[model samples]
Target chain A: MKVAVIQFPGSNCDQDALYSLREDIGVAAEYVWHDSTSLVGFNAVFVPGGFTYGDYLRCGAMAATAPVMDEVRRFAREGRPVVGVCNGFQILCESHILPGALMQNVNQKFLGQDCYLKAINRTSPWTERVEGVVRIPIAHMEGRYVADAETLARLEGDGLVAFRYVSPTGELSEEWNPNGATNAIAGIVNDKGNVLGMMPHPERATRKLLGCDDGLAIMSAFRLLPVN
Target chain B: MVTVRVFVNLKPSLLDSAGRTVTGALHKLQFDEVADARIGKTITLQMEKFDEERVKAMCAKLLANPVIEDYSYEVLN
Candidate 1:
């Protein structure tokens, strides 16, 4: 199935996502400009990471209102796969397509580093094949995730957490968290389990030549999404 | 025409990390009287007419993220 990689003006990771999807995963994926209002031919959508709209107003705020986001919202409504990475994640939250918000990192710095993550909810189609500590790079100024107490409880109770920061040994601890995200969360799935959002750049770590292949497992989930 | 000003701030329950950095900077500047610091932004709009309902809607829809922030606005007549 073909994938639609939504491209905003400031998106820098669209090419990386295309490369991983086409070269590594052997999926047909192409860029769809931000102003586009259609996703008819694509079965899945990917919102890649970048400082969209130069991060004006707030990270992802302007980009969330981009025309393509309406289609992204519609696509997600159709029970299809939608994965937003880094700034994409922020956009999703800003658009209310995802719960919670990505706040300034606890340290108030743009952190860029490889961090370990464990699949907290492997049942999701987005992370079902991903196992163990999946090392991926996170690059963002506002990557810390926060949600109200009621929403947090629902997420925890419903197994909506797709992944969580963890030590090499899969131990959850503050020391393993680089962004101070709530409950060490690295990624989360929508209630329908079709939409996934996370700050880590799985697209950047998808191949062996890139110095790591752990991201392949994550991509594989998107590639081999079940035909339900 | 009237002007409406909106203020947005992170919820008090959340850690204002940038605010904390400002506090640290202030401490280093010898402003020891500062207990804590919080940061927020203000936006002003010049409109043909001031509609409180529309302004609140704008705040909820775009000016602020209710998940992490709160917003209030005042009209300048």
Candidate 2:
């Protein structure tokens, strides 16, 4: 099955995603421009991270309305894996494919550093094989996640949460909550479990030579699913 | 001609991080009278006629994120 790496005007992580999916996961992948309106032969889609539309109106707001998002929406509806990372996560939320919104960091500073994550929704295809804490780097000015009380409750109750920031030993604390995301969430899946949105850069950590490969399991999960 | 102005801001329950930072700077400047600060944005749209329904749709669809933000608009002709 081919993986379609969706690329927006300002997307910078498209190459990395393509490389990881090809070299690391051993899959067929190619770039799909934002103006494109189809994902015909692709079984999985990846919305890479970057400052799409120069972050106009709001981060991910403009890109969310792009033509390619329509195709991504189609894929999500059919239960195909659609992974959105970092800025891609913002775009998916803006497109209403995912719940909640990402806001400015509580500290009001751009963060570029390694973050630890723990799988919260272990039964989904996105997190089923993920075990223990995973180290991934995050680079964003607006990464804090916000949702209403009822939504948060529903996500938690429904087991839609994918990952949460935590300490090395899997402990939650203020120090590890880099952006003050509610429940220290780092990632979450849609109700159908086909759309996954997260604030960390998993593509950057696919090789152990790059310092950490904990993200490989997460990023490679798309191939593990049968495209159902 | 009609001019529509949209104001968007985080909900009151959510923390305005940038506004808090600005408030800290103001306190450092000895502006103790400023009890608090909240930051928001204003977007203006130009249209041939004031269409309240269209403006509402725009606000709901793009200008503001209903999840964490609230929006208000005014029309001037």
Candidate 3:
């Protein structure tokens, strides 16, 4: 089960993802440059976090139009798992693989801290093994998730909400929402449940030396998915 | 040559923190008459042909995120 970690010009976390998948998760993984036009052999694609294209125009706007995205979209259509973290989430939204836009945090500040995320839906393979609330580190400026009311309702009705910010007691509240994301959403999956885009950096939390390894549950779940 | 000016703003339903901060600063400067302040972006594009449809497509596809923002454009020849 080989995974492909896409590397944009400004992607700073590609190596971290590669390490987490290759060393920590003991999975075969490789980096695919943004300009590459094909993604033929990989069973899964991981879009790691970073300031892609120096965040030109908008976060993930330019990177979303990269040559590799076309092939990424094709891979996604084949029912393969595609996970995006942080800026990766923005690219997914910009590419329309997921509904909603990640606007500037309501506080209008760059936030970097450990946040609690509740697994709202465990049906998807990505969250099947993740139980209840988990702590993950989030670092970003434009992570406030927003969508139209109809789309939001559809996402809720379809059970596409994968994770949401929650208090230490697992209750949802505005104060616990670091970015003021709508409904305290921290992550979401596509209608097919194969594509996942989330703000937290799971790769950064997979090692014990990093002070936490709670993120391994999600990665372990993803690693166990059947390859197509 | 035609110049297309695109205006993009966050939808009224969403809060604009940056715009609100700017409005607060303006109020402190005694611009008390300002009822409300909303911030948006304007992009000026130079095109060889005046193709309204193409410009609209550009705005829809890239200039603005339809999920959280609205966009309009004016063509100046």
User: What are the DockQ scores of the candidates, in order?
Assistant: 0.92, 0.94, 0.83
Selected candidate, larger DockQ, 1 vs 2 = 2
For candidate 1 chain B, which ten residues in a row score worst on lDDT? B50-59
User: What RMSD, rounded to one decimal, does every model reach?
Assistant: 1.1, 1.0, 1.0
Q: What digit string (tens of lDDT, one per residue) describes model 2 on residues A107-222?
A: 88999999999999987787887899889999998999989999999999999989999998899987999999998989999998889999999889989888999888887786
User: Please, what are the lDDT tens digits per residue for candidate 2 over residues B17-52?
Assistant: 999999999999999999899999999899999888
Give the alpha-carbon lDDT of every model.
Answer: 0.91, 0.91, 0.90
Interface RMSDs of the predictions, in order, are 0.6, 0.6, 0.9
Model 2, position A72, has a per-residue lDDT of 92
Fraction of native contacts, model 3: 0.81
lDDT (C-alpha) at residue A218 in model 2: 87
- In model 3, the clashing pairs are none
Question: Where's the lowest-lDDT run of ten residues in candidate 3 chain A?
Answer: A219-228
The TM-scores of all predictions, comma-separated, are: 0.98, 0.98, 0.98
**Residue-level error in angstroms, candidate 2, position B23:** 0.8
